[model samples]
Target: MDQTTTARAKGSRKPLWTKDFLITALANLLLFFSFQMLIPTIPIHLSQLGGNNVQVGLVIGIFTISSLLTRPFAGRALDILGRKHVLLVGLTICALTIAGYTYIAAVTLILAARFVHGIGWGLSTTSLGTVIADIIPPERRGEGMGYYGLSNTFAMAIGPLTGLWIMQSYGFSYVLLISTILAILSICSSLFIAYPKPIPPTNRAKSQRFTDRLWERSALLPSSLLLCTAICYGGIVTFITLFGHEAGIPNVGFFFFCNASMVLLVRPITGVLFDRKGPEWVLLPGAAFTITGLLLLSYANSNLSLAIAALCYGVGFGSIQPALQAWTISRAAPDRRGAANGTFFSANDLGIGLGAMVLGAIANWSGSYALMYRFSSTLIIVFLLIYGWSIWSYSLHKKAAH
Candidate 1:
């Protein structure tokens, strides 16, 4: 048998963990830990700087806008410029911007720093996804990605809690220092990874139109679905702390802890299910869980209710996200995987950015975070409808082909 077939057979027989995979996963974990540490805390920081909800949303959302804009170009660059160079530069930028947060005395400066940070985020994340895709065995992609996603989950579980505690105990400056250190460590870990050699762009790849280079068509469906889900996620990450205060809860960070814990539990199972069954089986139940969680969260008044909502949302999001990612990668040609990852993440950033801005406005207009969450739940319903339509249309197309 040829090497590809031989590798597949071996992969099927044994687990797909390599030293490179472990190091890469570690790097991803540290990178996300640094990012996640700031997700909930930044709004609080902005609030202390005399920013209102609208300003908070703009500052937070603008980061994703810049990240979103950078992703398309970053994706193309990965295909041309080589992964290590992109990854290191991105990490370095992230570290510097994160450190700059400590010195910012005004919300406007924070906004500018966040925007610059997004560029690094876009570049690093796309490169990481592409690098991991290269390391993973195709036959076991779902499983590998699930395990890989656990790194993010682990970061989510600890990063927010740690950040909030540090902010509460020491101050925001200490939080920035620690986060910057974590990001630097991430860069260090990435240095050890053996990146795959870039495949030289074919003449056709080189001659592709500018617009065509920005996205991969094969990834559109899954990316679209992920975008919808990310909108809801943006609301949670951006406002959950404020919501907790509104509901009279003492500690809001527990919600993230519970949510991430459930994700840690569910991701592996969902990954296996996706490998054995398909995206449909994982996605349908996941959507239901997410919708239910959102509704529950909208009404949550106590820790118990919050925990329940978090668990449901966690199961839904954790399962759906990796499945969509694996689906996106599986559909793309090897040389185009970077672009596919870019498209996938771009959709994510767009959704989050839009969600933050729109939902912030809703929260301000209604003067109720609870009402905002109720509205957020509706978007997932849209996700369900779209997915249902896609499935129906796909079935019809298959029947016609047959």
Candidate 2:
């Protein structure tokens, strides 16, 4: 083949191993590792740093606030910039942010680190999700996403357990350093991935128009019955860590491990279910399991109780997340998949972030973890009632139109 022909041929050839997928997965694994590593330990860490319950909430809450604030801009920037470049920048920022935590002796400095970490997280996660959507075929997107989510599940599963082990033998700074190293390694892995060139805007500023569409969809999400399922699911996942801490639970690691295990186990099964049966059927049971899991958590203070809660939570989270995503995906056309996901996840993120912030603050004000659980349970019920209204309204509208 001539030089141009040979180059084109090589460019068109698929890799034997799909190295891009692996690299992306490693990056995701690293992101979750640092992101989740402190989950079981951070409350204790803040307490050690002389922070009161409110400050404890502040440290955790600041991260979500910063992350949630950055989502729209992050999504837009990913569209404007190259995914690999953004991914690399995010990984480097993550490494520095995690390392910065080791220097924080005061709660304020710790909160600063968390806020910066949130920015890094926002950029990195947005790029990863969009990149996967860019690479995967529409027909198989759900399956591809299902497998991709396993990266987070596995990392979340391992991070807390490994973090605790390191803290037991080494120290907090050392564990922080380990998290930094994982982040840096993610940057290295990202370097191996080949991102396709940015799609030229056929209509200038189409991304902006897409963003506008997203905001409107978001307004509808909260009142949508199916969305209530997502909202309730979000709150529970965000605050469950606090639940473990209050019980003087020695093994927060084990608690999360059970959660991750269920997530790891359930994704494939749910992927097929979404593929065959569609999203609505899977979502209801998913919400049911999530509610059941949280209730079990409310009742259980021991490790065994915690483990059962995790099992219930794991199944609940695994099923609900994919079902919601697939539902959103099915509702949109291929051209707008990124926008659709941007809209869907923004709601999901808002639910979780707000859950952490508002509920964590409430937990602090109430002066008891048990009260927080009770509060969360009540919110879930409220979510269900709202969701039921949306469903009924839709049914009546369809009947009238027919």
Candidate No. with top TM-score: 1
- Once model 2 is optimally superposed onto the true structure by TM-score, how far is the C-alpha of residue 245 displaced, in angstroms? 8.3
Residue-level lDDT for 112 in candidate 1: 89
- The global Cα lDDT (0 to 1) of model 1 is 0.88
Q: Which ten residues in a row have the lowest lDDT in candidate 2?
A: 1-10
Q: Candidate 2: where are CA atoms >4 Å away? A: 1-17, 40-49, 103-106, 200-254, 301-306, 329-339, 357-402
After superposition on all C-alphas, the RMSD of every candidate to the true structure, in Å, is: 3.5, 7.2
Instruction: Say which candidate scores most in lDDT.
Output: 1
Give one digit per residue, the lDDT tens place, for model 2 in 117-158: 888877788678777766654444455667788988887777
In the range 173-210, model 1's lDDT, one tens digit per residue, is 98999999999999999999998898887787778898
lDDT of 2 at 120: 82
Q: How many residue pairs clash in each candidate?
A: 0, 1
